[model samples]
Target: MTQEAHVTQGPLTTEAGAPVADNQNSETAGVGGPVLVQDQLLLEKLAHFNRERIPERVVHARGAGAYGTFTVTADVTPYTRAAFLSEAGKQTEVFLRFSTVAGNLGAADAVRDPRGFALKFYTEEGNYDLVGNNTPVFFIRDAIKFPDFIHTQKRDPYTGSTEPDNVWDFWSLSPESTHQVTWLFGDRGIPASYRHMDGFGSHTYQWNNAAGEVFWVKYHFKTDQGIKNLTAEEADVLAGQDPDSHQRDLREAIERGEFPSWTVGVQIMPAADAAAYRFNPFDLTKVWPHADYPVIEIGKLELNRNPRNIFAEVEQSIFSPAHFVPGIGPSPDKMLQGRLFAYGDAHRYRVGINADHLPVNRPHATEARTNSRDGFLYDGRHGGAKNYEPNSFGGPQQTGRPLWQPVDGLTGGTGNHPTPLHAEDNDFVQAGNLYRLMTEAEKERLIANLAGAISQVSRADIADRAIGNFANADADFGKRLEAAVRELRG
Candidate 1:
């Protein structure tokens, strides 16, 4: 039989699908001369590479994201008239991004760091984003010290490496970081995976409904995957084998239809009762105990779809606590207030001014209109309408009926002063409670992880300062870690 010549149709083409003249060389003055300016492809390629990296977030640079829906499991219409959570069994489209706060983009996923749990709810009202973290506490409560705190968590200026001495120095000086440091060194510090980890609205927020009723609230996204953890040795091995373990797991699980889910429960307190509470209700490093404010099941959230393109959808995705639909607002937690400003600013730096134009972040409600326009990558059609508001062109206007409550009456101090300190502000109670709840094996693993890591600090003073944090969490917790470090020191 004669073998027919199987001819492949064509040669490679440029982005415009035009036939390329040369694959090897750019248009140049001569064969071995400098490249010519007429080479559009060469210029385009180099220019694109130069702009490849948008600014990385000063924190939460490493992350994994997925598409999901939040289905309301209970009727909380009385507490929050927010459309997504009011109707029982209503499915609200959501995108969740799990992140490690202190690591860079290429850092290990299982490193002992607080994971960011941010959810963007695309609701009928608008886009409601609950920007939170895995742990219900933070190292600092005030916004003013955020830059300084992040500086310590990042690289040492001279060595350009993360130093325990630098981190501990900040913790020692700040004092407010003690509570969160305890949680960070606990078993939950390095979660087994994005699935096994729990998510929390670390700062208290507000939920209000019709009839002028307002309630202070916090959100908890409990992983139905069941909380699990890896030993320090196991995590180190995984990190070496796969730095992108969490990212791969989330994508593969969703692809196999083994969707990860979390039960959404909320702790609510009456607005009137907040002022009289024993602790600062707005403090980020504090949690409302279930005994005092039980978790009212509101819904379930599941991540079922992986991003089609990781960089466009997952990397570029942004969440802001300030992006609330009506009926939900921020609490006065100093950290939360700081985040409200920081989240958007970081997004602006990372994805540019037109980030809102990205599919993942753009508000779903078609009726949405704002004065925002014309920046670096302006894509809006310029509206071809009025640039400013208050025009008689029947432009978008704010509504009066579905009202927004003034926060002036919500927060009260002696005019412009801090609230009086409460006894519960000591910051040790919750940390101690968390320590006592740990299983003997879990406690053992936590102590071992701390001592093993802290032993590398080299400086005796730095190791001692870090070990002292455990002592505050529990006497036994500190003692074991100290003994281990002492042996290593010798």
Candidate 2:
């Protein structure tokens, strides 16, 4: 075969494929200082640049996803009355998304960041999404500071670079972030892959009963594949070699039938316990030490298949802590409250008004009937059915039958008062526990990790302030990290 290559000139086109003319330059005012307002191409380019990125997720943008199934393993109906977790051995389909916090969509997966572990359960009741993360602790305990916390993690708009000063400065000022900051510099911060890591419901949630009893609960999805991690050095090397390693691993494993599975376990506490507990249970930064509340095995989750399409199934899939089935509901964790409202708003902006209609986001078994219709990518055009409810005409009716547990009267007594700070509610305890649990080698690695990151902050005081967070976690851990950071500075 003879090959001939030539530049084929084509007609000029606009950003959306519309034909354009006069491509040389913008319509200029006398070929100098200013451009004419009539130049449509210039307007389009400027407008597009203004909105170059969809609002990046407040957190967990760098991620990978796969489809999975949750098979009921235990009889938990006596504990709570949720249909999906109703019958033992019954299976419901799920889609799981794993992601890195504090990074953009194109950022590296192994960036020494917490990984988001969000799961969507397509149940008979509705789509139940458990949006959690790899780490059980978060940097900030309150939701009010969430936006400011995220701002530090993101790029500095002025410089278009990640500024370490912004990070350490923010954390140091807000001592509440000390616990999560410690975890960020620890061993599990950079997971080897989505398959080899565990997931946690980080915030405590309320699981109510048919008899109107509310139980405080936290979920931990222990990976059957075993929790594995990459040291900072290993993670840095892997990031350069493969930025999409975790995403690829999840996809490949599911395709090969080496399905990754997790044991779904929950620690349930009676709502009354929140008052007398050693720590404030609603605090997102604290964990109920397993000794106080042991993990009870409830079910098995296995990701056996990957999404057939990335855009529709994986990318567009939205999981919010707000989305709960009957028996499950949100706790007063401030972040949880903000998210219950923010997630749906985010989906509206990024995916579209009708993103839920996408198969991955939609309830698989339970039909969605609503009066809303016709937005971008609208799949349901009301289907010739009356859009208005309360119409005498035959229309989809709200099921009067008893379904999911009601949220009324049950949570009324829970009250809106602040969670009283208890003895162990301070952020440093769990961070210290995680540090103490580390092996000597792991401890050394943690020190090295801290040194590596804190050294990048231009100001020495900022670097020292970050080390202060480690100190709060543990005196020795802080001292070791401080010494290491000093060595780097020297």
Candidate 3:
């Protein structure tokens, strides 16, 4: 059916399909004598209005999404056996969501925060989700500290507002946060719009080919619109003038046939090289330098269509890193490991257990066949199929082959253990390198940004500790930050 047929132009009817004679006036007893309880329509309207909203996501509550196509432009058969990327020119339907990390649903888009770049691929094999962020590195390497890090970013319990003291204290204590903190304070922190920034699958992932050869890979989506960013003053003005600037820009551009696109690429590392790499390749707080493994262009991702219903199509949609195809699998990255369980569990709580049955979340090219039966909002898609395996009724059975190859070594007994340290694993080196690579004006802006927040911290010692981390990264960075903060506080 065409889009126009979906529009209802007939006489109004109740949800139960009963024709309603009068919708404007409720059926009252003797003309508004206490608004009679017999009016089912009035009651229905009131109840639905009360329950219109579902629970907002704990993080990334402010977001926008678009429907798109990912056309493979290169042959990667030597690296992966994923059916979606099996041949050049293959196209897959995709939905991409852009979000702010710390904002609520009503928050403004032109803020200085890391944007979430979560992509869902509706492929022949199954749904593949790449849950990433705009920046390649994160605040911390381990998932154990995730709650604490977010707590620092969120409103303080006592004050009920985000406190600079809380944010700085956490970063000061966790030296590993230096790299991401630097990135956060830089020019790109406030992206000009969703279409102008780059996105990265920050964590390492495992990719195995048909020959069972394993490789580690990272994904990058370089915007075709070119990089653009807003300074602090520009962002403040835009935020106040029009809070929905980013969303409006994206929607109107698509409406005008100016679809945004990104060049898709991946940096693939041989599985053996990961063992003896300079730093732990799986560290979420670090990046594998392009010199070690250059990104190879593989595809083009174009967002040509806007969501018809923001609430149904975008809000109800879900993405999980654990939703992998045959060739792709999770790495040993601690942050990625925790997310494998957390993302799916969050959807079950926030969106309901049958969330997968929603049109926006369902697989496109293949029917989802599972013995798992009913839950909230279950559509009865299986239609009385056997609910369990090993039945005479011929229920769906699992494939004998596993999705990816198993790890070779299994030496350690189960206990609380830290990731094994590699030769050059300390946190400061990369952050320091980033600082030195900045142009003089860029460095000035970064220092000013850091100082602006650090100076707001009440405790002098906390401010000192925070600046000390930068000092550890580079003596000049620390000195300049200290001088800037001192001037600001004075």
Candidate 4:
């Protein structure tokens, strides 16, 4: 066999961009002696290799992202003075990520789990991140329960495997999980593809107009491709056959110019209505009824480009519900309040204090000049600027108007106080209403899915408790789930 000559395209270099002398061999003390620490190349390579990967996200670790554009289709200036939505035909760049909630970084993309639908909109004012999920409601309403709920989703420390009993026990104990559990067990839990599912800002957010009037809002990104789901059997088969099926599907579709899009709509309620609303609109576990407040079309989102580098653009990209521009702010939702602090802290630890300085995460239209100075990998753009506020020197001063001022006569003690409930705040009511609203086919599928999951729980008590939760939602839902579980177990 004839051997092709090796071609040297470029010289190997260290991370610092210094030319490498000998990448293949390490310096040693004489021939065949112990390797010397003087070998900078070997030391550098080993050290970097040891720390190559950053810590994966505690949840929604597995994800795919794309570059997109968000175009204002309707005038929302009366609702929000946000520059991005100030006029029709206005467009802003966006990065959207879709992920499975209960999966590790290497887990199958086709798993039957709630999908994340996070978007970062780079507008003229600033970047606004709408961190949300595919489902309209979350499992728990309180931030205090978030850690425990996530623990249940993860593997058991003792067994090093997923524990069905642990999951069922948590769900059963936390009745607020009933609504989300119903959604999860249904066919929609396993979306056919990321493009085929809707995205929702699960918590109520505050939007203020130029006149300082506030409106509570819920965002919905309805897929233009139409809603589609995979049955458990099909999802399981696809998981085995192609673990990265969803990621591949999105990428290939964009490459073929069949760009996926979503129509952006928001359900708005008057600020005064929140005080007398039938339910707590801020509760993450509940959904705003469409009949009460219909969706108002605002914009359209379309994914037109794939990421050039997944690691830099997708993996390092960060989005937070707290990252809001002028005219938009967080509501009094306990979960959203906690997330305002938690998401940024998590990103700082996982990436670095300078994670926001990365090209993908940097504010595209504005300069971020703050007292926050150097940490690891800071870009040194803070060069010679006064790192303190209230100085005479012309540093970046606060420019934008405040979204909203603090409410007057606020009195509250810092404790684990439950959010004051309304006359219709029973956890079971909405869940039951959801079940009653479903068609017979959907109801049957929901029962089968719930049974399949509950039957896997080793503890009979846990299984019974979970069934009781379903009963609390609706008698028929409970009865059917109980029968299905018995048949499956037998």
Cα lDDT of all candidates, in order?
0.82, 0.81, 0.93, 0.90
Q: Which stretches of candidate 3 lie over 4 Å from their true place?
A: 1-7
Weakest lDDT window of 10 consecutive positions for candidate 1: 1-10
Give the C-alpha miss distance for residue 455 in model 2, angstroms: 2.1
Clashes of each: 0, 0, 0, 0
Candidate 2: where is the Cα deviation over 4 Å?
1-58, 397-419
Q: For residues 15-75, write the lDDT of model 1, one tens digit per residue.
A: 5766777877788898788998989878777888898777776788899999899999988
Candidate 4, 428-468: lDDT as tens digits: 88889989989999999988888988999988899998999
Of the two candidates 1 and 3, the one with more favorable TM-score, higher being better, is: 3
RMSD of 4: 3.9
Local accuracy of candidate 3 as per-residue lDDT tens digits, 1-490: 6555544767787778788889998776786577889899899889999988999988898999999999999999999999999999999999999999998899999999999999999999899999999999999988889989999989999999999999999999999999999999999999999999999999999999999999999999999999999999999999999999888988998999999999999999999998899899999989999998999999999999999899988888999999999999989999999999989999999899999988899999898888777888888888877788778887777888667777676697998788777999987888999999999999999999999989999999999999999999999999999999999999
Candidate 3 weakest ten by summed lDDT:
1-10
Q: Candidate 1, clashing residue pairs? A: none
Give residue 149's lDDT in candidate 1 (0 to 100): 90
Q: What lDDT is reached at residue 146 by model 3?
A: 91
Model 3, residue 266: what's the lDDT?
99
